[model samples]
Structure formats: structure tokens, C-alpha cells
Target: MNREPKAKSQEPQTSGRSDTGRSERAKRAEGLPFASERLTFLEHLTVERGLSRHTVEAYGRDLEYFAEHCHERGLALPPQIDEDCVVAFGPYLASKRGLQPVSIARALAAARTFLKFLAGEGVLPADPSALVSRPKLWRRLPDVLSQEDAATLCEAPEAEAQAGGRLSWRDRAILELFYASGLRVSELCDLKLADLDFQMGIVRVTGKGSKTRVVPVGRDALETLRRYVALLRPKFAGPKDEDRLFLSRTGRPLDRIAVWALVKRHGRVAGIPGDYSPHTLRHSFATHLLEGGANLRAVQEMLGHANISTTELYTHVDAKRLLAVHAQFHPRG
Candidate 1:
């Protein structure tokens, strides 16, 4: 552990990432404590697993942190990882990284996956993370918007859409698409010309793990998207824009951060309270549907949740609503 930081400290830094067979990122992974195994795992993640770049990057960081921790104990990951090492990782994350319980649990999950991968590869005899208890986190409900607030936010850009400006209906369309279909930010950005069916009022979204699902879009949202495509997207489409449904001023497809900034900007424009983000609209979309008597299975399908349990969080509603229902229906009261 003590010798590794020095070995890496003297190594020259490499800039720029390549997506070739052996990328710079993969090569850097090879420089980690478990050089070969880690590099192979990372390459597997990109080539075979087909994880998104962001997700793969996160997994790589997790492995790097674990390797750094191991570096503190030994020059590199030992022939075998014991349970004690996995247990120590939790405290290390808490004491050194100041990670919250949820974050720590997530990091541990990444480690567990890596360990399992190594075990399968015969590099490790068994998974050390198997016996470790992940931090038990409280079920924190997501923040949701009221119907009126969501509508207000969606229309906030209308006032500024005058005379076919630079933004035009693009921002409004972004918000509407989020609220209407409960699409994740990445799914929204990944949308393409072939994904939309205007006649059916649905959008085919490629979600996490490259899973695709058709989510119905409201008529209003479809209309806004149509207007944005017809008015702005034509000019925004560059030779390289491909068939992406959303684009920046430079005709490049919008990235996650750009769309998030757009959402927050319009949130302030709507004068809504508390911080607003793209996911807030998604949460609102699920909650409003459940409150409107939408079936749980249906909502789960719409949200593209692999598990119904994840979708059930919207069933919590809000404390105020629960109390009101209790007051109205409880006979003992």
C-alpha cells in the first residue's frame, strides 16, 4: 500500500481519452494496483457490457478508490481479498471520503461487482464483499411538483419565445417532454428522429442498460416538440447533428448538463420554490399519475423501471395527503 502511491507519483500524466481497442482510460486502469484485472474489467464494461460512458466512468472511479485504499495496506490488491478488507472499506469511506450512507452503499456495490467479476475470472477465490453489510439507508422520497407548478414551469418560456428567438420553443419543449413522458435526462438527450411517433403521440426511449420502451407523450408536449423541430431544429441541425431531436445553438446534440441547466433556468423563470431539476419533473410525473388512478404496473412501464419496487416510492404520496385521508376515513378519529 505505502509503495504504490510513490510508484504512481513518478509516472507521467496522460491527457485525452480514446475509444480505441485500448483506450487511454483503460491504459490508466492498467496502471492501477490490480493493473491487468482492472484494465480487463474496464474493457469488458465498455466493449461487452455496453454501459454508458458516464456509468462506466463512475465504476472506474470506484475501482480506483478501492485500489487506493488497498495501496494504503499493500503495494497492490493481494492474491485474495478477505472479509475484513471489505468491512474496512465502509469505515474508510466514512472517515476519509465523508460519504453519506447511500453513497457508501453505492460504492460498496461497485466494489462487490468488481470482486464478483474477479472471482468469476479465477483471479480471486471468492468475493470478499459478499459478507459485508451495506449501509442501510432510509427511503427518501423524491421531490415532486404540483400539476399547476409543472404547467407553469412548462409555459414559463412562452413569454420569451416571441418572434422566433434563439431559444424559441426549444426550452419549453424540453420541459414538456420531461414532464409528459417521465423520461430520464439521458433518455431525453438520446432521443432521435426515429424515436418519435407523432401520429401515436409516443416517444421510444432508450433507457439504462440500452433498454427501450415506448412512453406516451401528452398532446401538448407533442405539439411543442413538433414546433421546436419545425422551427429551430432545422437551423440547429449541422452536418454532424445526425437525427438527434434536440440540439444546441452550434447544432450539436444537447448533453446532460446543458439540459439540466435549461431546466433550472426555466424553473426560476416560473418562480417556483425550491431547487428544480429534470428529475423533479419525472418524480412529479409519476406521483401525479398514481394520484390520478394510473395503475402501478402501467406507471412502472412508463418510467421504464426494471423493478416495481423502485416505482412504488411514488405510492408514499405526501404526508399532508395521507393525513387528510386519515382524517376523512378513520372511524376512531
Candidate 2:
């Protein structure tokens, strides 16, 4: 879902001409190209643009690298950056700087956004970044677990199914929900008791930017969740009235890192090699549905994709199965 950017608060002002004098001196010592302006833009992205903290830090780091590039070449400020300067920096990032294509592309996007912001603020006459092409990037498909591997991973937590294990029901529910719903780690973590409707087999997931979508939970997942709520969750509840559906051993909401570790540990038990995380379950969920002939648009809605194009990636993953069907039935084959 698209959201309007939030506005950032202006920098605080100090009383007296003495403070003003200090500001001027500081700006002079920092040179005409003050890094503070870049920081102001970042603040605007956070408050006005309503960008996530992760995005803000990434953009800041990208711009800082660009600023360092200008410093080495004796450029005064971002306003002085022309199209040729940007074009030169691209090669510098690739060849001299030895950054990968994806990294360079991200850095270029950051530079372009900064330039656009400068133009919008009337700091620059035109955005020099507009003249340059963004670096071409190869899309890497997400690693998906095979159907057997997915089942194995889900079953790994069942070893704790024996009585006296801590929160085994909750862990099992978490695994089942991830495979059944295709939720991002953050979306899963954000789930609350009120968001679930066991009778209706639906889960209300708040996705990126607080956008809410209701996703259907499979019978198995619903059953697991019911078991968790009924038997295990009370054991983990704290004095505070937290309504989170899933809790850690500490009775607090589970963070993404902990979720990652859990998935990784289960992957080892399942005998699946290489890196695997919560997102792999999501990918496996989507890919499995597509392979089973689920409609793309329907899956898109369930996955809470703002654009259908993002959901098309699963089509690519299921293409091999499509080819097999064609070979089996097509007269030409």
C-alpha cells in the first residue's frame, strides 16, 4: 500500500546572536558543502517521507559514500554535482571502488533521490541524477524449500511434542502459520490475539506501512494456533496485558532475529543445508501454491503485495511445472 511521507520537525534553534555566530563559524569550518544538509534530507525522509528506519540508514550510508567521493575530487557541494560527475562516480564504484552491481545500483538510487530532494527544495536548479541511467541489476530468485524439505522443517519442532517441553505448542503454531500463510517475518511478529478469528480461519496481518490484510489460515495452522492459545500461551504470559498472539520464552513479543534463529535451527534438524530463514517459508508457501495452480492475482492479495508485478516472481518459479504440463499435452510436443 502507498503511504504519504511524514514531515520531519525543523532543527531546534538557540537563543541569542552568540548562538547564530557559532553556527556561522561551524558552517565555515565545515566548508560550503556541509554534511548537515544531507542529514536534513534524511530527517525529512524519516519524518516527512515516513520512511522506515532501515531505509533511512541505508540512504544515509549511500550518501555518505558519495560525499566522500566528492571530497576526494574537491567538489564543493551536492548542488555542484553534474551529470558527468555522477556518471564518473558509477564507474568509480564499479572499478576503482570494487562494489558489486547491486551495491552500486543501491548507491546510485540514493544519489538520485538526494538530488531530487535538492531540486524540490530549490537547492539545485535541476536534478543531475536524472541524466544518468540506473545500473542494471540481475534479479536473484529467493531460495525455496522443496515440498518434502518444508514438511521436514515443520515436523522438526514436533520432536518437542512430548509433555514438559517449554512452549512446544507455540513453536509448532509459529511454524505452521508461516508455511500456511506466506507472511513476512515482521508480519508474523506483529500478529495479536484480536487479529485471529479461529472460527472463520482468517488472520488479520498488518504488513508494510501498517497496511492490514486478512489472510486465510489452513485447517492445520488454525488447529495448531488453537492448541497454542489454549494450552501454552498462558504459561508464558507476563503481568502486563500484552495481547500479542505469539510470545518468546520471556513472555514478550518475538523479534525477527529470534525468529531467524528458530528457522535456522529447525532447518538443521530437518537436514536442509545452506542458509534458511523465515522468508524461505514464505517463498515456499507462494511457490507451492502456484505449482498447485493457484491464481496469481489471488495469491498476490493473500501475500499483501501492493503491485501484482511483485507477485509475478512466483510465476517464474512455477514455470518448470508449466513446461512439464505442456510437454505432456501439447500436440506440437
Best by lDDT: 1
lDDT of 2: 0.79
Per-residue lDDT of model 1, residues 1-333, tens digit only:
364344233222322222353375566656668867777887888888887776777888788778767777675764656888788888888898898887788888888898989988988888777777777788888998889999999998886665334574888899999999999998898889889999999999988777789999999999999998888788878877578898776577777767887788778867999977999999999999998889999999999998999999889864556778889999964
Deviation (Å) of 333 in candidate 1:
6.9
Per-residue lDDT, model 1, residue 115, is 91
Residue 16 alpha-carbon offset, candidate 1, angstroms: 11
Show model 1 residue runs off by greater than 4 Å: 1-31, 78-80, 318-320, 324-333
In angstroms, give how far residue 311 of model 1 lies from its true place.
0.5
Flag clash pairs in model 1.
1-71, 1-74, 1-75
- In order of appearance, the predictions have TM-scores of 0.86, 0.78
Cα RMSD (Å) between model 2 and the true structure? Answer: 11.0
Residue-wise C-alpha lDDT for candidate 2, range 202-308, written one tens digit per residue: 99998765568999999989998998898889877899967998886557787666677778866786789878899999999999998888999999999989899
